[model samples]
Target: MIIPFIIIALISLMIHVMEPVKEIVLDRLNGKITYPKTFIDKEHRTIEFDSLHVYRTLTTSGDFAITGKKIFIKDRKFNYTWTLKSNECLEYWSFMVWYMDKNRPLPLGTAFNEYRLQDFERRKAEGFSKPLFPGTFHTPERTPSQHRQRKEIGGW
Candidate 1:
């Protein structure tokens, strides 16, 4: 019993210590260097975007590609086709959307920061103040009752 308690305590301590390190690593990997018209990724690869496309350096041989598109309002998924490989990619995607659109709310699961807080206020002023987490005040729209009712009514 004492050995089990010690093991659990060690595991908890390790997790507590590693959580911040993981967050720091993620922040660096996902962070970008911004300019007036473009930004650079973690590998110092330049990325530029317009309304329709994200142009980025894709190869070490200096080839560039349209790697992604600007996110539109009401897009709930980070990558609709589940193509992105990691959370770092998702963070980059979220940052791209954040950079491109000033009137939209922060993407879901994004942690609040000073810049994002300011943007949230700006978006709220523009009447796009949806909370990042659903069901904050009440049950979400797709609760079990709603699901059952929709099934009963043969709704999609």
Candidate 2:
């Protein structure tokens, strides 16, 4: 009985700790930026790039609320809207817009940087790399000053 209780407790703790890892995995799997003829979501639903719509609204706190919608063309037509209400929303939205634009490179801070640490670090080092749109998003990585110092010291 005690052994079972201990196992349950450990499982619960592991689940709690794995929450962020699970989210990251889902984001990576679902948020892939591609300009294929058709876009496939994590739910296995498919929609054309031209048919998809991306919208941005202002939140009460003056931040942005980016949302996307698509109309399915199956026997039963339906509308699917997706809103990423997480810290990675900015990056995801950037990728989405870039994909829609056929993968043309957007401005440094306006783009997702394609998971390149150097681009991210350079953006931080330069500082003031604000997004073209207004949003209250944050990437909780190394400090701007630290990155700037690293750049000054010939670090990549």
Candidate 3:
């Protein structure tokens, strides 16, 4: 009797935990308006980058794509997913726009950085000496001061 009870309890506990896992998995697969999901392996609480720059990258695809999800800036809003093609780069942004729930329209704004796609991170990671937007405007892993000096020197 004791063994049977313990097994039942364990199963119940596992089911309780798995419910959330099931919901999250199903939400992504079934949700119509989901964000792009990135496949980065780093653990972080905040993903930061420039909004204007991200907007520019949205038009062009890099060599690789991250599996990232899109969501609102509001608290605990990792709800939607954006899609990205195979064009990927080392430093890029991928997001999903969830527009299925509310009737309210997304505010008209040139800035799209407000929409954070979960699990998004830099890719094709280069050495510390590598540039961010190499052929474009920014460089990776450079301090603000160093970037300023490079800018003054007209280095790309």
Q: Which candidate tops lDDT?
A: 2
Per-model TM-score, in order, reads 0.25, 0.28, 0.19
Show model 3 residue runs off by greater than 4 Å: 17-98, 101-104, 107-156
Ranking by TM-score: 2, 1, 3
lDDT of 3 by residue, 63-144 (tens): 5565443322221344323322334432223222222111112223345335411101121111112232223322221236
- Higher-ranked by TM-score: 1 or 2: 2
Task: Please give, for residues 33-79, the per-residue lDDT of candidate 2 as tens digits.
Answer: 22212233333344444444566543443354434332222211235
The full ranking of all candidates by lDDT, starting with the best, is 2, 1, 3
Alpha carbon lDDT of residue 82, candidate 1?
17
User: Could you give candidate 1's per-residue lDDT for residues 46-93 as a string of tens digits?
Assistant: 222331233323323336554543322221222211132343664566
Worst 10 residues of 3 by lDDT: 118-127
Candidate 1: TM-score? 0.25
